[model samples]
Target: MSRSGVAMSRRTRLDSELVRRGLARSREQAVAAITAGRVLVGGIPATKAATVVDGSTSIAVTKGDDPGYASRGAHKLLGAFEAFGVPAPGPEPGPGAEIPRSTGPTLVVAGRRCLDVGASTGGFTDVLLRYGAGTVVAVDVGYGQLLWRLRCDPRVRVLDRTNARNLTPAEIGDRVDLVVGDLSFISLALVLPALRACAVPDADFVLLVKPQFEVGRERLGPGGVVRDTALHAEAVHDVAASAAMLDLGVRGVTASPLPGPAGNVEYLLWLAAGAPPLDADVLAGAIAAGPAGPGRRA
Candidate 1:
């Protein structure tokens, strides 16, 4: 309790608290508002990257409207679905499964189970459900970061404070047809095996590749953002190589529709188990050309 007669305790990360309480749609949006000098900590402007503050501090945002989903990550995946022709999963016939259907021959998630790695604020989970996924096991290392809207969603299974790198198939209880990851800070190589364990043969994967994390520490600029075009290409190559090592085929790579925190450029890659992956030249060409824009409609 403060002298102002406010109960302030249980310090929490500003970004996560914003999502959990429905003040923001996603942690990315909260970070955006905070970085833009829009977020208030105890009625004062805050700009730190990750600040722990009392939940009762009367946090407010100068921004007028909140995001459409819990996190900006949703828009990134939405871009892939639009660019690559991935469609919504089909209706659930009965109790437990959902199948996906595409307008063309593109693979769908109509009746597939999914795992959302780094499911903070449940933005990806939210997208998965909206596309009619029967069930999405949303996992994040941080606790209580999932938005109430996502938490209340019957199709999403919230797994807070759980690291995807440590996950096992037994923990998930069934093989999944799709796996999507938007992980940060760690190398994808370390977590790919864990995610692979959860996927059934022929399952597809969509991963957000953050060059800042994939490149060597020396390549990163201030605030941990990657900016060099060469570095971006190298990072993508590293991820492609790693996927190949796992016997996962990289079908395609596309730039994210949205820039990451601090305006870092990012890429999204689609991989399928047992299918032939994209060649190095193809991956490099995609990077050079940039994400297939809205002009390349799905």
Candidate 2:
């Protein structure tokens, strides 16, 4: 018991506490917020998901703004689209306001038949829809994680329990013109083969590259983050190598505008039929092109 006669109980994870307080929808969402520099505790930014804070800790999100997508991932995919000049559907998310989207087929999201692998909570799906994808097949290994709004939309074909590793064009019915993915807990190399098998002859994809999941655990530094810039390049090259073997040409690799959950810096790898992975020097430059993240979050 403290001076106020309130007991300070057991310390719990910051992410779980955020969920318990309804500040975030899930632990994953909480971590996403924290990593995006959206979460603050006791007037300070939260640097990791494992921050041991009490349930009553003074936790709050930055500015109470709607982070655009269903989760912070919307910012990530949007960053990829804009940085790569792909463009997505919908208005820019900010100032508690929504931005309007383009009208027709863009070089990317607009008017495309798309697939969203690991579409948890529909951040990527929301981007696709807002950008004008003719249709979206939301595939996830888990069940019932997509937002209800996306679930009810007729244009979205929900495929729950569908592992991207096992996905085939036959399963999706028609080839998708564009594919966007945000997967966790598995190396992308395992999912690339299936993603290749399900795309249109010249389909393109924008997928999040998580280094912690790609590099063996033994290589991860404290708090399970890849702190070495060299390792970041290696992970990209390794995954680019995987894509090449499948004949999915790598277009570019850019550091995500946002860090991944738990402050893990992530990259967006663009793949298509014609382009090849950026040469080592070019890729190194791209990896450092965006905002220098992984600062406070670490």
Candidate 3:
């Protein structure tokens, strides 16, 4: 059903499709997640779980919108840790490699104070807690959105109706050791300054980068997806450059094991205070690897 007069394929409900694809374990879980706005179709947020979609339409679960793991996004962070070798979780990429995997010392969080931005449903917070973080300050722009379980947990300090752009060390009581963020809608450029302000002089960070939100609207294509590889590269480059300006050293950039809702390819940009930004060649190499498909395993 297009101007070309091509026949349209059959459509299915978002929740049912999730179960059909094994993206969700059960219909009830799918419905709960979808109703919570955790599902996206064709790069746009689906308003209803029952919305119909055709084969050409790509549907994906929003990161951190899972019924389990505090948020579906917890898996994404765990993958980042393993891939980035945060606390050295997996194999280290060889020299001259575009991205390094599994190479950091086991920097466990037994005594680390943490900050979770875009702490929607406390997905990242959950990960920190599971790793034995000392304290977790969860910040989000919405109210009553965090699951009651985490909202009431002693280890989690919920700061609802708060914006990362306005965050302060005073608000958090102290600078943090670990800062993990999974934000949406806003560009990283806008939030990095606030993060810089709230982080300890040497805080380590792992931030989720959604290209659709970072790339200018002009760079986006139909359905708000940024399909052009060059545009994708530029999106990440711009974010890295912004961090450089703030003196946050680049650790590495890797394709997320999970894509953004609506199937937009996303990345995890790791940084730390006082470390050097990655050389241009290394940056370019990572870009050449591209973010178009299921990328190399970290």
Candidate 4:
């Protein structure tokens, strides 16, 4: 029943409606805007992208709500790079400009091939490209979630509906110099082997560690967040051990600058093939210094 005496059509998803109404250029942008609390329905804030609305329902995007990236996951990777002092590629030197030489061993991203596991909406992939990765193969289990601009970028190869646990080097066509991941619902241990198989020798890795997925269900507090600091340490330690068994060294670990979508305090793990295992003391210190609090609804 409509106020104007016209029957409303079937409900449409908020993200799709944003696209249909030209409020957003793509579903990815719509999701980002929604997640950032910028989307309004009938003059009230809309919380979820999956929310359904009728044809006549009013929708609005808040002004000046840009997040500066396709997804907030970009901040997680950026934080890791800063905490670990990983070198970002500088702008190209103009003709005859002086080139600076490195004084120590550094994980260089310039002109390097990369693999982005669980690259939904291409947040991490966007950061990699901005930092100067030459090529990025974005793999996700779901279909049609990447930003349209990233899909059109020649440097990005979209591998939608592909499971990372079964990923192979042959499919990627070449060994990657770096690997970055921001997976959900799945344990990193299950996909570490596949990631290792697709990387070059001595390749670098920056993976988000979601404690809620790594810790057993019994350990999770309300709302699926690992609130106990001890549990957080245990989860990270277990994943680091798993990587070690696969010959992947845990180079560093740090808390993400921003909490996860659910306000779960997530971690960023830096790994490298053939590097030394992470020291137990360093692991403990990182967990102790991490964001101290329980998860909350964002």
- State the lDDT of candidate 1 residue by residue for 41-62, as single tens digits: 8886664424576656688878
* Better candidate number, 1 or 4, judged by TM-score: 4
In candidate 1, which residue ranges exceed 4 Å CA deviation?
Answer: 1-67, 88-105, 291-298
| Residue-by-residue lDDT tens digits, candidate 2, 158-275 | 9998889999999898889899999998999999988988887799888898999998999999999898888888888888889888877776666776787788889888887777
Candidate rank order under lDDT: 4, 2, 1, 3
Query: Against the unseen true structure, what C-alpha lDDT does each candidate score?
Result: 0.74, 0.77, 0.73, 0.79
TM-score of each: 0.69, 0.70, 0.69, 0.71
List the RMSD of every prediction in angstroms.
14.5, 10.8, 11.4, 13.6
Q: How high is the lDDT of residue 188 in model 4?
A: 94
- Residue-level lDDT tens digits of model 4 in 4-38: 99786978778778989999986657766765678
Question: Which pairs of residues clash in candidate 3, taking residues 3 or more apart in a chain or in different chains?
Answer: 64-73, 66-72, 85-88, 90-102
Candidate 1 residue-pair clash tally? 16
Considering summed lDDT, which 10 consecutive residues are worst modelled in model 1? Answer: 289-298
- Candidate 4 positional error at 38, Å: 24
User: Model 3 Cα displacement at 29 (Å)?
Assistant: 14
Ranked by TM-score from best down, the candidates are 4, 2, 1, 3
Choose the strongest candidate by TM-score: 4
Candidate 2 ranges beyond 4 A from true positions: 1-68, 87-107, 290-298
